[model samples]
Target chain A: MTPPSGPRKGRPRNADADGAILAATREALAELGWGGLTMGDVAVRAGVAKTTLYRRWPSKNELVVAAVAEQLDELEMADLGSLRADIEAVVAQFASLLSAPETQAALLALFAEATRDPLLRRRVREAIIEPQKRLVLAGRAAAQSRGELPLDTCEETASAAVDIIFDTVAGTVVHRMLVSGEPATPDWISSFATLLLAPLAGIGAGT
Target chain B: MTPPSGPRKGRPRNADADGAILAATREALAELGWGGLTMGDVAVRAGVAKTTLYRRWPSKNELVVAAVAEQLDELEMADLGSLRADIEAVVAQFASLLSAPETQAALLALFAEATRDPLLRRRVREAIIEPQKRLVLAGRAAAQSRGELPLDTCEETASAAVDIIFDTVAGTVVHRMLVSGEPATPDWISSFATLLLAPLAGIGAGT
Candidate 1:
C-alpha cells in the first residue's frame, strides 16, 4: 500500500515494500534489460508509488545494486564433510545463481557501469562483492576446523590467501559460464573442485 | 583515404582503415562508454566513411567484439622457462590489459549484452574467448615439455582441463581487477601463480 505521505528518513521502512521493490527490480531487469529498466516501471510493478520507490532508492543504479545484492544473499555455504565436497557445493551454488536470467542480464551491466562511476563501483563492491566473500571466509574456517587446511601464522598472508581463493572460485565460475559460454555442469564442477582443492591443500601444507 | 565507393563484398579490405576503425572504437568506448558510443562517431574518429565501417561490421556488437578481440590478440605466452614463471607472466599481461580504460569500459558491457544475444555471444567466443584459450594450451604444452606438467592421455579430459585452466586464469584476474576493484599487483600475482602451480602439478601427477 502507498503511504499517505512518504515516510521521513528516520521512519521505520516497510519490509514488505522493500521486498516487493527488490523483486520488481529483478523482474524488470530480466524482462527489460539494464537499459530499459526504469524506476517508475519498477514502482508500478511493485504496486508502490514513485515517491515511495525514490524515497528508498535514490537512483536506478542503487536500486539495481540492492536487488542484485539480495539475490547474492541467497548463497549460503553449508559445512560439507570434506573441503573438496564443500568447494563443489559452493561452486555449484554460484554457477546456478549466475545462470539465472536476471543475474545473467544484470551483473555484467552493473560491473560495466561501475567502471566509470566511482560511487557506483564502491556501492557494488560493498553491497555485492564484499558480502559474498563471507562464504569464502566461512568455508576456510570450516576447512581449518576439519584439519583439511592449516592455520596461517601470518595475518597478512592469511588475508591474501582468502582474497586469492575468493577471486579464483568466483572468477573461474563466472568466466566458464558467462565469458566462455560453457555450461558449469556437474562433471565440470567436480573437476573444478578437484583443481581448487589441490592449491588449497598446498596452502595448508605451507608450500 | 576514403574509398571511391564502398568496397564490394569480394574486394580486399583496407588494413589501415580496419586498424583505424578498431582503434577509434576503443577510444570511443573509453570516452563515451557502450551506451553513448555510435557508429557515426566511430566513423568520424577513424577518418573513414560510415559505409566502410558498416560494410565491415554490420552492428555495434560486431564492431565492439572485433575491437576487443584485437586487444586480446596482443596477449602471447612465451616459454618463460617454468610453469610458474609462464603463468605469472601471462597473468600479469592479462591484468594490465584489463586495466586499460577502454577495456575496463567495454569488456563487461559487451559480455552483458552477449548474455541475451546468441549471435554476439558466438562472435565473442569465436573471436576472443576461443582464441585466448590457445595461450593456456600452449603454456600447458610448454610445461609438459619441461616435465613440469604431465601430458594427458585422454583427449576429452585434456580439453576439459584446458577450459578449467583458462577460466581460472582469466576469470580470477578479471574478478580481482574489475569486480573486486582491487589491483592485481606483483605480490598478488606471485601468490596466484603459486596457488595455480600446486593444482597444476597435481594434475600432472594424475591426482
Candidate 2:
C-alpha cells in the first residue's frame, strides 16, 4: 500500500503526529480542564512544535473536539440478540463514558463554549454526537425487523421515532450522570429498561 | 406578611436590596459569563456597594446559583388533567427556558464551573436541579391517582421510577435544546409524549 502523493513537495505529513497530539490533548484536558488547557502545553506534551500544533488544529476547541470524537468512535453498536439488551448495553456504555472524569470535564466545558459559538457547537454535534446517534437508528431498525416495533408506514414517522428515542436514551443517561449526580448502576439500568421497552415490546408478537 | 427580625441590622436590611443584587448578578452573568463576572462589577450594576453584595452572598458561585434558582422558580407544574399533557407542558416550559440566550449561557457556565467544585455542584443541585425535579414527583402522584399508573409495589420501586422519569423528561429536553441545538417544537413534543406515556399506561391497566 503506497502512500498517495501529496499536492505539496517535502516530507509527507506525519500521520502518527496527529495521534500523538490528540492523545496529549485528552491528557491535558484531564489535568487542566478546558479553561486551563493551552495549545503550547499540548504541543510540549506531544513533543511537537507549537507552530506544528497550530497548523494542524488551528484552535484549542477544534483540537479538543477531534480528541473527544476519537474516543466516541469506540461507542459501537452490538447485536446482543434483543433490542432491550442492545439499548441497555449502549446506555451502560454511555453512562461509563460520561462518568469518566476526563470526558465529563471536556464535554461540559465544550458545551459551555458552544452556547456562544455556533461553529464549535456544530463541530461537537458532527464529530461527537452524530456518530452515537447512528447507533440508535441501527438499533431501531433491528427492532423493527424483529417485530419489536410496528413498521412505519411513512418516512416521517420513522425519522420522528429515531429522534425521540435518541433524545430519551441519551438524554436520560446524561441527566442521570451529570445533572443528577447518580451512578447508572445495574439496578437503575434495569428499571429504566423496563419503562422504556415495556410498551414497545408489548406491541410485539407475544402480546 | 411580617418579615423575620434579624439579629442586628441597619434599617432591617432592606428587602429590595436582595432582589436588586440577584438581578444584577444575572445581568452580569449574561454580559460577562462565569469567567468574567465579578462581585465588584455586580455591585456596580446593582447600585450597591461591593461589601454589601459580599455580605449577602459570599461567593460568585453562590450568588449565581441564587439568581438562577429564582428563574427556575417560574417552572411550576401544571395540572393539565392527563399525565401526557402535563409532561408535554413541562417539557415545553423547560425547552423555552433553556432556549433563552441568557439562561442558556448562565446554565452552561454554571455547569462547567460546578464540575470541579463540589460545593458549587451541591448548590446547583439544591437550588436549580432539585426544585424542578419536584414536578416529576407531582406528575407521578397525579398520574397514580387518575389510574394512569400503578401504585408502586414498594418504596424502592417508586423512588426508582421517579428518578428515571425525571431524568428522561428533563434530560431529553435539555439535550435537544442544548446539545443537539434543535427546537423542541409541538410536533416533537407530541412524538415524545406518545412514547413516554404509552408504556406507563400499559403498566397501569396491566395491558
Candidate 3:
C-alpha cells in the first residue's frame, strides 16, 4: 500500500486528494453541519481511506480550517483604480463568502470550536484571517498612494489606523451578513462604501 | 416531587430554578465547553431533575441561548450625555461581556448552532441581537439631537444610517475583542469612538 513516489514529488497526487477532501468536507458541512460531520463520512465522500484523511488532518477542526482557508484563498484584491471601488469589491467578495450556505455554516462552526481550542484558533487566525488582512494593508497603501488617505504621522499611528480600518471593514460585513441576517446587497455595499470613505475623503481634501 | 404551592403561582420557584440553571450552565460551559456540555449534566449540576430542565429548554441550544440572553440583559445603554462617552461606555461593557469566559464561549457556540438551525437563529436574533440594536437606534437619535449625526433626509435614509452605524459599532467591538484577540482598552475604546464619529461629526458640522 506504499506510494510509488518520492516525498518531493508527492504534490500531484496529494493535490488531487486534498482537493477532493476539501470538496467532500464542504459537502459534509452542507448536509450534516459541523456537529454531525465526521471524518469517516468525509473520507467516504472523497473516495479516500479514513487513515488518509487522518494523516493529512489530525482532527475535524484541522480539516475544516484547511477547507475554509482554501476557500478564502479565492479572495483577491485587485487594484480597481480607486479605494472606494477596491473596498467595495473586497466587501462584495467577503459578503459572497458569508452568504454561501456551506461556507458560512462551516466558518461559524470553526469559530465556535476555536473559542475553546487555542491551537485551532491560532490556525484559523493564521490561515483564514491573516491572509485577508494583507488585502486590507494593500488597500490602505493604495489609498495613501492615490491621495485618498492621509499618511499617518508615525508608524504607531499607521498600525493603529490599519487595525481600525481592518475591524471596521471586516466586522461590518460580518455583522450585516451574519448577525443582522441581512444580505450585503449592492446598494448596501455602496452606502457602506460612502460611509467608510467619508472621513478619509475629508482628510484627503483637507476639510 | 410535587411542591406545596399553587400551580398558577409558580413564579418564585421557577425563578429560583432559572437562576440556578443559568449559573450551572455557565459553569458547565467554562469547564466542559460547548461540545462537552449536555442538558443532563447541567441539570445534575443545578440539582434539578432532568425532566424539569427538558420541559423548560427543549435542547442545549435553547438552554444556552436563554442563559446567554440573561447575561446580555445586563448590556444597558445609559445616556452619558454625549455620543462619545455613551459609545465608549457601551464598548467597555461589551468588552467585559466578551472577556467573560463563559459568555464568550456560549455566545460563539450559540452563533455556530444558529447557522444551521433557523429557529435557533430567530430566537437568538430576537433575544440577543435585536434588543442590542435598540441601543444603536437610541445612540443615533441622541447624536442627531446633539448635532453630531445629521438628521436623515428620509425614513429610508434614516434606517440605512442606523443599520450602518449598528454594524460598525457592534462589529468593530466584536472584531477587537474576539477576532483580533485584543483588549478593548479605555484608550482603544476612545480612539474607536473618535474614528467612528469622525465622518458623522463632519456631516453634523456641515464641513
Candidate 4:
C-alpha cells in the first residue's frame, strides 16, 4: 500500500480528526492547564500517532493556537444597528463567552504563558486576538456611523476597552472560578460591560 | 548578645531600610524582571541580610508588592472636585507610572502571577486595588454631588474601566518594550491619558 501524491493518502485524512484533536486539546488545557499540556498527551487523547500530531503542528503552542482559533471562531459577533446598540449587544454577549469556564481556564494559561514566551504571544495575537480585534473595530465603526462616538475616536481606545473587558473579566472571573469552583456568570459580564461601554455612548454629555 | 529582647534588636531596624529595600526591589525587578527577584537578592542589593529581609517581609511577592506600593503610593489621586478633571488626573498619572519600564515589568509580573497565586492576588488587591477603588468611588461621589455620572451608572463598570486602562497600558506597553526594547516614556503615557480620560468623562450619560 504505497501512498501517492504530495503529502496525501493517509487513511483518507478524516476531517473530523482535526476537530477531535482540537477538542481534545481544549479539554486537556482545561483539565491539566498550560504548564501541564503535552503533545504526547494530546496525541494519546486524540488516538493519533505522535508523528501525525507533530506533522500538523510543530510545537505545543501551535496546537494551543489551533485549539483556541477553532473554539473561538464559533462565536459570532452581534451587529445591532447603532454603535451604542452594537457595543451593548456585543459586550452583553461577550460577557457570556469570556466567562465560559473551559475557555477561561485555557485563556488564563495562555495569558500566563505569554508573560514568558514571545513566539506564543504572537500566536495568541494572531490566532485569538486578531479576530476579536476585528470585532471591536467593527463596533467602533458602527458607533462612529451612528454619531454616538466622535469620528476621531481612536479605535485603539475603544479596542482597548474591549480588551479590558476580556482581560479584567478573565482576571476577575478566573479568580472566582479557581476559588469558588464556579464559572463567571453573565450578570457579572453585563455589569462590567455597562461600565466600560457607557463612555462610548456619550451618556454623560450634559453632566 | 542575646539580651535586650523588650521589643526588638539589631540596629533597631533602620527606618530607612524599608525605603531602601523597596528601592532595591524596584531596581532588581526592572533589571532582572520578577522571576529573578528573591529575598536574598533584595537583602544583598539593599545591604541587609536574609534574616532581616524575612523579618520584614515573608515572600518575593510581598517584597514586590511593597515596591509597587511605594512607587504607586507616591502618585497623587486626582480629587480635583470635578469628575472630568479627577479621572483625567488620576488615570493619566496611572498610565504614566505604568509606562515606566521597570514599573511595568515588575507590576505585570506581580499581577500576572496573581492570576495563579491567591495570596499574592489578595495582597495586591489589599494594597493597590482597594485604594484605587476608593479613588473611583470618591470620583463617583464627586460626580454625584455635581450631578455628572448617573447614580445608576454601574460602579463595577466604572471600576472595570480603570482596571482595563491599567492592564491594557501595561500589556500593550510591555508588549512593545519586549518587542522593541523601547522604554515607555512620559509622552506615551500622556497620549494614552488624553485618549482615555477625555472620553471617559462622558461615561454614564452615553446611550
Write out the backbone clash pairs for model 4. Answer: A195-B157, A201-B206, A202-B206, A203-B205, A203-B206, A204-B205, A204-B206
Candidate 2 docking band:
acceptable
Model 1, global lDDT: 0.83
Instruction: Put the candidates in DockQ order, highest first.
Output: 1, 3, 2, 4
The total of clashing pairs for model 3 equals 0
The CAPRI-style docking tier of model 3 reads medium
lDDT per residue for candidate 2 within B1-207, as digits (tens), equals 123557474566767888888888877776666556778898898898999877777677777888888887998788898888898898888889888866876787777767766777898998788777789989888988997877888998788777788888888888888888889999898777877776677644431
Write the candidate numbers in order of decreasing TM-score.
Answer: 3, 1, 2, 4
Top of the candidates by DockQ = 1
Looking at model 1, what is the TM-score of chain A? 0.87
Error of 2 at B31 (Å): 5.8
**lDDT of candidate 1 over A131-207, digit per residue (tens):** 88899999989989988888878998888788888988898899888788788899999878777776667644422
lDDT of 1 by residue, B1-207 (tens): 235787678768777989999999998887777766889999999999999887887778888888888898999998878888888899999999988988977888788778777777888888888888899999999999888777789999899788888888899999888888789899899878867776667544422
Work out the iRMS of candidate 4: 6.9
Tens-place lDDT per residue, model 4, B10-110, is: 55657778888888888777665654566678789899887877777766667778888778776665667665567557655655665565675576566
Question: What are the lDDT figures for the candidates, one per model?
Answer: 0.83, 0.79, 0.80, 0.59
Worst 10 residues of 4 chain A by lDDT: A173-182
Candidate 4: stretches off by over 4 Å: A1-74, A80-85, A105-123, A140-207, B1-59, B141-207
How far residue B7's Cα lies from its native spot in candidate 2, in Å, is 7.0
Q: lDDT tens digits, residues B1-207, model 3?
A: 123554775444566888899889987876666777888899999999888887777777788888999998998887887888888888898899889878767877777778778888899999999888888888878877987666878998777777788888888887666766778888788877777776677654431
Q: In angstroms, give how far residue B79 of model 4 lies from its true place.
A: 4.0
Over A164-190, each residue of candidate 4 has an lDDT whose tens digit, in order, gives 444433334334443222343555444
Cα displacement (angstroms), candidate 4, residue A194, comes to 6.0
Model 2 residue A37 distance off true place after TM-score fit, in angstroms: 3.4
lDDT string, candidate 2, A156-189, tens digits: 8778777777888888887788778899998888
